[model samples]
Target: LAALLAPGNFIVMGAALLLNGFAVAPTLTAGLAAAERSVVEKRKTEVLAWAISALNLGGALPPAITGYIIDTQGVSVAFVIPLVCMSLSVVMILPYLNIWREKVREIPA
Candidate 1:
């Protein structure tokens, strides 16, 4: 944030964070919704527990891996790794978005 507050960088960083939040919110929400929807009625609690565990694991794994990479390879390369990972996630999720939209449409009138 201090780095972001530096003159011209502030505007750019703010815009990036804004865009990131917009993109992340729906993706994260959909992931949670999908997890909920996928559960059997009787086992919803167990499924939710697994879903939360998976979410935490996903959140933790990248940072740990990235931190290790940064320690060994330097900060710049570590930063690029997330860009690549995010790009891949977007590519993979794009198809699923259409599927999700169809499911939404199919909900009873």
Candidate 2:
């Protein structure tokens, strides 16, 4: 948010994006690992394929949508799409968050 809202500071935005880039790999890996671990061995391959498909679709769609929003409503409104998504994801995940936390705790890190 700070990066997005930073007043004419491209450097801050770049740095923020760079930091965010660092998180993407670990987050995706953990998500896929958890997804695989949650299912039976026979179903693991199917689950992984589905996960990859979703990730691919997710990666593909957002930029075009965001670009359209920016073209139509301008830069200010473009942020709303992600903010709403982030908020909605939080709301949807809150109930299951404790369960995930416990699962993470069980991992032999």
In terms of TM-score, the best-performing candidate is 2
Candidate 1 yields a Cα-based lDDT of: 0.76
Q: lDDT of each structure?
A: 0.76, 0.86
Range of the 10 consecutive residues with the lowest summed lDDT in candidate 2: 100-109
RMSD values, in order shown: 4.3, 2.6
lDDT of 2 by residue, 45-106 (tens): 99999999998998899899899889989988876788897899899989998988776667
TM-score of 2: 0.80
Q: What lDDT score goes with residue 61 in model 1?
A: 95
Enumerate residue pairs that collide in model 1. none
